[model samples]
Target: MSRAIRSAPSAAAPTFAALALAAGAVVAVLLGVYGSVHQPTGRTLTTLGFSSLISMKVWLAVVAGMLALAQAATAAWMYGLVGGSKSAPRFVGPLHRATGALAVLVTLPVAFSCLWSLGFQSYDTRVVVHSVVGCLLYGALVTKVLVLHGRPTPGWLLPAAGGAVLTALVLVVMTSAVWYLGTQGVPTSTGY
Candidate 1:
């Protein structure tokens, strides 16, 4: 029905944005940590900035970061829907949708790159955990309508907003942890 279609986009935006934000936060932080974590020599991170992009760690992080930014746009759109504002219509809506779609487009390359570079190892718990978390976040956004039990909130884009912001926060902390550990010259445990 037209009713269902009308509400779908609005609700979906928040969920997508939240997932992106969370993933982005994680990626950004992890990139930072990659440099901080030191080996016995503590010089392994000197080349982090440029090298990161080419590395498995950095690739995923970048994907997350890019997606996160896109998600922000999406959430903003959702917020407009909930808040009954047309502020997000100008460029936010299209930009959000494009970015979300683009994120998915990039997923294939990232996934392939990860599989090729990291091999079956990156398929370990730590990587899988992150993947599952990211997927859950995405799923939550995409399926929010079904879960809402009939479009409950008008200005309740909070769940989406909160999730996104939290994701960014978590990314900062997690990446910081990784960086701190690396800075300490701990061994790079890929299986984490």
Candidate 2:
């Protein structure tokens, strides 16, 4: 490859990472806002005074749980960009960035809803775990943002971020599986 052409991938990298960080930031901020607002009092689900189609729990879960899932896909998409064990194609780079960014975008609503759900006084032990992990994951995402800002995007960072995100997802999904299965489960989130 010529020197001029070789520079293209590197130049393109910062843009991709910036997009990922921006999307992630939006997701995290929205979630943080929602987490701070949710305060369910009675077991009954209430309306948000919007269209008649939405319920509070449904809206919140969709936002929080879905955001978590979207972030997971973002991690994989990042890995796809990084293309460990194989050199990532030029086309794949954009795809990776796009997917990662999209995942974060899709997650924004869920994140806020999650935060909103926590506002409710009636809480479960599982929720506490979810909250802590959510914070840690968000913190990791912030680190990812800083990393992107400080350096050009590298292939390895994708997997690292993905691994962090996947770990969080594991905790979120299989909270009680461990004790039930006679093994230690992942720790719960504390809304950090």
Candidate 3:
């Protein structure tokens, strides 16, 4: 067990860590600013055969959010923060990385559609919350990825980043997807 753990590669180079941190911060800030200021066009692009694009986005976000939840759980297990397991199975690391990648992949289209079509809105309380949370969600993701790649990172940084990512995703789901479903009724086409 110890040998397996020891076999994992050491932290990344200091130069890489610095670059990741700076680049990640800049990207996050740009996203936040862009989301905040871009005027909503009040139009959306739909997936093929979907009655409404919003419904499709909702479902996609939910799936990504659920995957993110799995990533968080696996992370907790890896850190011995949950499941009472002293050592995480080898599969846990791969699962975490795979799920994380999938979550990000699924979210990309939704984010692009939102940013291109909606461009942030706040006509109502829910709209405001949703728009803000959406921006934060991407920001958190960038930070999490940067920290994950950074060498000599603090022990607490990874977990904290993961927690932030999970929180942001949950908030995005609640404010947008869940709220839309509760208020607008789930579409029969998607059966969600």
Candidate 4:
């Protein structure tokens, strides 16, 4: 009888996943370290039509958070985790990507303002939590991107990375924008 041959299992997927995770962890650590070491300028770029940098940042963050929610819904639809359809429509993927991109775009200025003006602060519980989560946000984003684009990875990896990103986003928004809006209320006049 002729011998039957079997293919060896490939380790590429696990290896890539590990590398991606390590890269993300490194980025997160570096950001925290840099923020901790760097001196904050106490000044940030101003946006026209906004009362203050803080107001602008808060509003931008809110917008980003909303976009992230949309991204989540679209992602769920694509995975058949939401809606009643067995298969996602062709538009779902594009919509998910667009919303994700928009969310990142909206948060860029806010992140820059926070990192440049405040650095990493730990004077209070809320501030510390916000700072920590802010660093985690970028890390999670990196990991999610890698997992999404990398070679065939375990089915669970993408969702885990996405969940991490979403969690970080929510925490960052709740700690910063929500807190600010609750305590300061909406800015009504310029220079507020």
Top candidate on lDDT is 4
- Tens-place lDDT per residue, model 3, 25-119, is 67766876786687756676556456667767888988987997898788778877777877889998889889999998888878877877777
Which is superior by lDDT, 1 or 3? 3
lDDT of 4 at 149: 71
Residue range with the least summed lDDT across 10 consecutive positions in model 2: 183-192
Supply the global lDDT for candidate 4. Answer: 0.81
Candidate 2's C-alpha runs over 4 A off are 1-85, 120-122, 152-158, 173-192
User: Which of 1 and 2 is ahead in TM-score?
Assistant: 2
Alpha-carbon runs more than 4 Å astray in model 4 = 1-10, 188-192
**RMSD to the hidden true structure, all candidates:** 11.3, 9.3, 4.0, 6.3
TM-scores for the candidates: 0.40, 0.46, 0.80, 0.90
lDDT of 2 by residue, 1-192 (tens): 111123333676767666666766665555555555655332323234423212332333344445555555444443443345334445544554565565455444434444543342226687667665665566556646555455456555555665666576456444423322345322232112
Q: Best to worst by lDDT, what's the order? A: 4, 3, 2, 1
- Model 3 score (lDDT): 0.72
Worst 10 residues of 1 by lDDT: 38-47
Clash statistics: count for each candidate: 12, 25, 1, 0
Using TM-score as the yardstick, the better of models 2 and 3 is: 3
What is the TM-score (0 to 1) of candidate 1?
0.40
